[model samples]
Target chain A: MLSSSKVKLIQSLNKKKYRQKYNLFVVEGIKNIKEFVFSNFLISNIYTTEPIPFMQEHQYQIISHEELKKISFLKTPHNALALVELPDTLPYSIQGIQIALDSIQDPGNLGTIIRLADWYGIEQIFCSETSVDVYNPKVVQATMGSLARVQVNYTDLKKLLTTSPIPVCTTDMDGENIYTSCLPQEAFLVMGNEGNGISEDIKSISNLKLTIPRFGKKQKTESLNVAISTGIILSEFFSQKEKI
Target chain B: MLSSSKVKLIQSLNKKKYRQKYNLFVVEGIKNIKEFVFSNFLISNIYTTEPIPFMQEHQYQIISHEELKKISFLKTPHNALALVELPDTLPYSIQGIQIALDSIQDPGNLGTIIRLADWYGIEQIFCSETSVDVYNPKVVQATMGSLARVQVNYTDLKKLLTTSPIPVCTTDMDGENIYTSCLPQEAFLVMGNEGNGISEDIKSISNLKLTIPRFGKKQKTESLNVAISTGIILSEFFSQKEKI
Candidate 1:
């Protein structure tokens, strides 16, 4: 049985302010919640209609389907929803091939990018303060389960790029062709906003500018989606690293 | 003034049955409508609140914002919406590095794939009949303007693969590493469904199977999103072609 106050608190997790205020976020679906259970993130509460086999060892509250629907963010609510405590913000470090996002507004794009980073073994992502919150319900859902592994930090991107020890690469329309260019094995790959490319402050500081050359005859495809571009660029970077 | 019957008719276009019955689809926003206007598709009607500079020569019905909202599919209605007649289906031909989708149910994924194909100069896409309709409003919106350039066809994927004169390639988990493999200059690349990848029938018929190797240590990410995988594979194919 869910108390009205408890339901209110869970539903409020949908907003950034509430998430920050409570230091908690929502993770729905048994599979998604399973990832967080083994992760560093602590589970604050688990509201479930059925017993999750893997989660039998953990404490969980049995609730009705109707009760589960009340707090679930998805249109078709999953069987279970868990309240997860937000992980502590780890200090950003420049390691081998990192991703920096500049004002990526779309939650789906950010989530997809995080999943891509996880797939490519890029551990950390540095997002501009203006980028979408990593903990957004939509972003979390889009990540599938990669949110458990990928460490995403929101900070001043310009400052981070300026003080970087390695080369800073930005994807551009007229830059040297990505295929032909000599890509650095270790650098900060900065992806810009959906509507605009990289910010001027961030772009001017980046010495390496690479472009995924357009092959279409019309040359009318404005640009690839930010998430797609990230996948393509990351694949290229990893492929080049493997060869060396 | 938009008629009540006309509004109902426009709203019905949201469903596949209605779209098929009328042989028409709705395209919203001035930029998107402009693309269809210049394409092979014919325009049946244009409902707009503001005068469009490029559409000056074409006929359009002026309507108030309230009227536009009533007829618009989007939450925030675009300045205009146009009803574009479905183009005649051309016979599917095996072209250089073409894309084939097997039961891609998500409209956004289909649309993004179409746009990615346009970016890589792959002109045609053959989708399994079970795949989402290309004329779906969500798909049309996601394709940006690329829908105007790329041709998408719905057909029996198994039959198409079986009859293909060119090499048939499919993305699979246990396949040759894409980075190391000598990719063909011209092949039919088949992308599978979001959940269940390449159907057994399609998989058995494909002679060449390629995989984007996973680099994450945990290797927990089950698979990349179908659309993101398409972008990476397309980018790799083009890169190899350029080198050759």
Candidate 2:
């Protein structure tokens, strides 16, 4: 059984302000809750339809389907939902290849990129202030347990790029072809907003402007989606590894 | 001003059952509305805050901001929202290089692929029946007006690949390295589901299995996002054209 106050607390997490005050975010669905149970994150609360062994480390409540449904954002409630404590603010660490986002607002894109970063073993991900809330439940779901492994921090993209010791590279249509561009092994790769591309301020800070050259045709497309572009660019880095 | 009945009608469009039964789908934003206006699609109704001269040829209705707000599904109501008559069911005439998706449920992926197809001039996209509804407002929004150019259809992916006249190639980790593989000028490239990759049932029909060779350390990423893989594979086709 969920207390009225507890239900209100869970609902309040949907807002950024509440999330800030509590330093907690909700992770919905069976797949996501299970992943969080094993990760290092502090499980503040667990609402489950059935017993889950991983939650043995943390206190949990066996809630009925109706009670679980009350707290679920999903129209069809999954078997479980969890409220996880956010990790400590990570310091800006520029080591190997890092991915940066400039005002990417979609939760799915942010989450998928986090997963991609985890997959490629990227050093870190830097997000501009306007990027989607990384702790958004949808993004956490999309990350597929990757949120535990990758370090994503929100920062001032333009300021960071200017002071960063490493070269900052960004993809642009008019830029040199990425296929032939001599990219450094350790660099900061910046992706821009879905509609606006990279901000003008950050664009000026980039050391190199590269492009994933499209095929010869009448391209009605104005630009590639930033996330998709990131994938291709990251693959280029990964493909090089396959050769050796 | 939106009448009570009209407001209710517009809100109903958010559901797939309504869209399918009425053979109508919503297209919002000034840019998208303008694009679809020029296309062959018939505009049934239009509600806008700003004036649209192109819409003179089609049947339209001017509504106040409050009325537009009542009907709009977007988080921030756009300048305009339109209801367009769904295009006539297009028969698949697979001729040149075509793209097929197996169980791709993300609207953004579907939209990005649609836009990419439009850029490369690949006219048709074949999706599994289980894929997200193409007319989902999110899908339409993500396409960025590419819906005007690309024709998308849902069908049995496995059956189509088996009988497709052109070669069917799907991306896989164990498959041949795509960078050096001899790719055909015209073939059907099948992309798999988001998490599961390609389904085995469809794999049975894959004639030429190709892989986008990963670079970096082998243990880094488990696999690439299907949409990112789509961009890379499509870029290669275009890359050859650039050489020409």
Candidate number of the best lDDT: 1
Model 2's alpha-carbon lDDT is 0.79
Off by over 4 Å in 2: A55-59, A90-93, A214-222, A240-244, B1-24, B55-59, B69-75, B89-96, B136-138, B172-185, B194-199, B211-225, B236-244
The two-chain DockQ for each candidate, comma-separated, is 0.80, 0.33
Residue B181 CA error for candidate 1 (Å)?
0.7
What local lDDT score does residue B67 receive in model 2, on the 0 to 100 scale? 79
Best by DockQ: 1
For candidate 1, write residues B12-126 as lDDT tens digits.
Answer: 9999999999999999999888888888889999999999888664589889999999988899999999999988987666868889999999999999999998888878899
Per residue, candidate 2 scores C-alpha lDDT tens digits across A1-244 of 7899999998888888899899999888766676666656788888888877765734777899989888887778788888899889766668677888999998878887887787667746999999888887778777767787676888888888888888898877798876665557767889988888898888888898888775525454557677778877776654444434
* Each candidate's fnat: 0.72, 0.29
TM-score of predicted structure 1: 0.98
Cα DockQ of the candidate 2 complex: 0.33
Candidate 1: clashing pairs of residues: none
For model 2, how does the per-residue alpha-carbon lDDT over B1-244 read when each residue is reduced to its tens digit?
6789878877888888989888889999988887787778888888888778765633666778887878888989998998988788787687778999999998888888888787667877999999988898889987888888788888988888898999999887889877677678778999988888889988888888998654334243446667777987877655544444
lDDT scores for all predictions? 0.90, 0.79
Q: Give the C-alpha miss distance for residue A215 in model 1, angstroms.
A: 0.8
